[model samples]
Target chain A: MKRARMENELVSKGHVACPGCGAALAMRYVLNVLGPKTIIVLPACCWSVITNRHPECCLEVPVFHTAFETAACVASGVRAALEVKGDNSTNVLAWAGDGGTFDIGLQALSGAAERNDDIIYVCYDNEAYMNTGVQRSSATPWGAWTTTTPATHFKGQEKKNIMEIMAAHRIPYAATASISMPEDLMAKVERARDTRGTRFLHIFCPCPTGWRSSPDLTIELARAAVESRAFPLYEIFDGAKRRLSLDPAPPAPVADYIRPQGRFRHLDSEQIEAIQKRVDEEWLSLLRLIENNPA
Target chain B: MKEVMMGDVAVARGVKLARVEVIAAYPITPQTIIVEELSEICGRGELKARFIKVESEHSALACCMGASMAGARTFTASASQGLLLMHEMLHWSAGARTPIVMANVNRAIAPPWNLWSDQTDSLSQRDTSWIQLYCENNQEVIDTVIQAYRIAETVYLPVMVVLDAFILSHTSEVVDVPEQEDVDRYLPPFKAALTLDTNDPRAFGSISGPMEYQKLKMARHEDMMGAVEVARRADDEFGEVFGRKYGIAEPYRCEDAELILLTSGALGGTAKIAVDALRESGAAVGALRVRLFRPFPADEIAEAIGDAPKVAVIDRNLSVGAGGIFAQELKAALYDRERRPAVFGFTGGYGGGDFTPEVVEKIARRALEMGKPDSPTLWEAIP
Candidate 1:
């Protein structure tokens, strides 16, 4: 597959985003496709901190920094106002962190999706709430360590199936993308832009600080996420049809994805096996989605 | 033009006259009727607004924020727990300065889940930067809604019009519903200073470091202060067309009275009745009703209390450990006064409990008997 040359010139060079921040890369690719005609609504999260404090901003596009649980609602408002003024071409994007999306902002997001509001809602899932010092979120993967979920008592529940929840709304579009694959991520964003009504994109954004991984391993970890089937690359249209974008010929073990991150260092053989079993279960569920609605 | 109407219905009529473009709401007692009427109007095509049925109070405010940002005049109504659930977004709406308008049917915040009149829910959100106005009757409820939009738009802040649940929300009273043509003429189409226009794409909320955060907060504070005068001007202008007058504080028989009662919401009406009866009985007692709670009319409250021998505050809302919510705010306002009156605080009529004129008279007589300053104030018994 040929990769398109990146054209996110609007993003400033040498900004303060941490090295190997998957969210930063996700923003880069999204801005490349969205161009300068997009307005981003950021709720309280790592992205809010990463964007640098005003009067100096990292992104070229106008950004409205909102409260922790109001990104979707604010974006919805912005989208409506644009349409009223006959400026319907601009893309209104609600960019939030896992905690903002899965917990505090869930009610607002659900309201927007249920109404089929014309806006793009993106959740850059870094597994935990990194900005507030790595507290556990509903999006935190099973058996992960954070300040709130210590290794002695790590997160026991599986990460909430956010994609499935979005699909439940029967929205026009819902997709899972990763920062490792810009082409796939950009393609999903472009598709969302073309479609009307609520569109959701959940990007697997790995946080080196939160995950306790080397900064350089960010892209590799993201790729491991996809290759291990821990975070599969897939899309659902009208919430009914699921299409698998990439099916690896040789699937990597879940250990490949977990071993690099210190957050998952406490998992013993039995615990690892338990996690693997859950991952397998979820992968099978995705496979069923694809098989039931081929293409 | 004056016809009998429920406070909730009057608020709904005001929303229609304002031509609010979007309404997102959920059902809660006291607040349910306002949303229901708005939905009916939307369904009948009497009001061209998108009525979204949301699952929770959080979502209702969230939807309103979205619609407001989209540059549409948006409205929503909630009470008690609903208002509490929308707490996080309340800060967001005000912080973003979306100028969203909300009708808060004042109800007691839950613990035992009682659905009755109280100012606790809206008053608790005092720091959220929302312009809060307490209505004395259905007439003021309608007028305040119109004035809220003008003040909010001028100051670029969200506004909440609070009416007592059951007392005003359910009770029918004579109110002059303004003509739609007059409303349109007075309240112009919402033209947001900042919006999501592709032609002039700009960021709204951005992360601010410690250096810029304080300044941003100060700017919001200044705007809030500006809303005080803005509200007064809006009210004056609204009266010019609608043939009614309102101020931050409405004085009733305060002249030459040795004792005065500071009150809000429908209780003001009851207090008025009590004051009239007391005056007929040759007792020197009057009433002062506070319409605007936030940007608190401190100067006006001071002047209203004047050199009265004693001033009694009646609060229907409790602040838990702090006592009456309004009483606490009132004390703070008069804290530095050179010759402050003996301030008395009374908490009663909570959770939809009625406070009749007899009860008001009783509290007044008790305050007059005490004749001295008291700490933590007095708590009125609901008899």
Candidate 2:
């Protein structure tokens, strides 16, 4: 797929976002496609702080800074209010971190999906709770080092399959994108906006501060993630129809995605190989789901 | 037209009459019946509303928030652990001023994991900026639900109507479920002052720096405190239409009594009975039922207990290292008053334990004996 570049320069330069902050770029692209008529529902995450507390907003759209776990719920409320006033033209977008989406906000997100609530829920996956000093979240990849999971006792759990969970709800639309793929990401946003019911976009957002990598490497890491099939770009409709949006490009080694970041620095050759096997298994499973359910 | 019903059913009936547009909830003990009845009503097309089946208590509130923000009259019910799970969104709903109304079936929090009655779950959320109303019977539960919407929407604040777990939620009583037409005539469709207006765009939930953060918070606080009057007016209007009035603080037998018992929820009935029994025994004991919790009704409470030698507060919930939650609030209310009654606090009837007349009589006797104020409020019947 040919990735499209963003046109509108919605985000101004000299903002306070850390270099290599995938969430910042994700916001820029999302706003570019969503336009100014969009209302962003943000739960507790780096973006909440990154937006720079009230009076000084980074994005051109309206942002509702909600609690850590109520992003989907708040957005649902915002959408309902808009509908009531015969203002259905505005888009209600819930932008949350992996900790908020995959863990805390899962229940609300699931409920919204089951009801087919008219809203867009975007999960910016930075793996760990970066805003709260790099703590481990369910989205944190296995064998990673966070403040909570010291190098000696790294995270042993696999990153939760959030896309599968959202798919299980049988929502109208669900897709995965990455910060590195602006065109694909914006295209997914446009697709979600066009559809009704619960639409989810899971963006593979890299965090240089939390991942222990150079700020400039964020986009490269995101691209590596997709190329390695570690984070595939795909979409599901009604939990039945699955579409693979991007074919893996030569299937880059798992180490190509993991080695540059400090979070995975402690992994030995065998651990890296183990991660590669797990990624391969997940990729094959997803591929099978797509092939078996071709529309 | 008044028929006997459980407090939970009355709440459901009230929501129906109010023409709630959306109902979202997860089933929890005590609270499950309310949502079940609501769903059945929606399923039968009796109420034109969307009944959302949520996976957890947290989602219930979130779904309701969505519906409420969308300008629908939204509602949900939960108890104890469920209320605890919805803790995060409680602030969101209030901070956003979404005006969602919920019925909290007051149940004890877990660790010991009991499903019986307690107020800790909802009372613990005092700082969440919600307008809270506690009910004494099935009738109040029904009436309060209706009144909550009026107050919530008027102030642009969310409101929680709390009923004791089984004592009120499960028990049957005669309740006059108001007519839908009457409710419609009285409670108009919600017109949110602040909402997502695309034509005239505005920023919400922006980060506030030191310059305006405190002022914004103070404004919210003032609004919350102002809700006390708003709730009273709503109740007044409800009574004018329904012909029954309930004040923020309901005084029962407090006149010509030396000792007064402060109670809330279903225990108010028991306390009233105990007061009658004590009167028969020639002991001057009275009862005071608190209906509105948030805004505390501090002035009314202090005045209601006026000149009584002693006042005993029976709380069905605890506050850990602190005493009962109600007791703590009452103490704070009476802290600066001169010639205040010797307020005594007692924590009892927790986690579905019944508070009978005997228990009330025992607390009254103890309060009469202690005539003078005591620090570190006393526990009622603690082993």
Best by TM-score: 1
lDDT of 2 by residue, A1-295 (tens): 6657666666666457787799999988888888778877778899888877556666666666777888887677667656645677788999999999999888778777877888999999999999999999999999999999999999999999999999899998999999888888899999998998889999999999999999999989999999999999999988889999899867999899999999989999999999999999999999899999964
lDDT, candidate 1, at B246: 83
Supply every candidate's count of residue pairs whose N, Cα or C atoms clash at under 3 angstroms.
14, 17
Provide chain B TM-scores across all predictions.
0.97, 0.96
Overall lDDT per candidate, in order of appearance: 0.86, 0.85
In candidate 1 the C-alpha lDDT for residue B239 amounts to 83
Best-matching candidate per lDDT: 1
**Candidate 1 lDDT, B245-357, residue by residue in tens:** 78889889999888899899889999999999999999999999999898887888888778887888898887778878778888888889886787788887887567899
A-chain TM-score in candidate 1?
A: 0.98
Residue-wise lDDT of candidate 2 within B1-383, one digit each (tens)?
A: 78988878888999998888877788988887898889889889998776767777787787677667556788888888888888878887888788899999998888798888889999999899888999888988988899999999998889999998878899898887787778888899887675554454556776677768788778889999899899889988998888887899988889878999999988888899999999999998999998889988888888888888788889888887887788788888888999677778888788656688998899889888875656456454432
Let me know the TM-score candidate 1 reaches against the reference structure. 0.94
Model 1 chain B, TM?
0.97
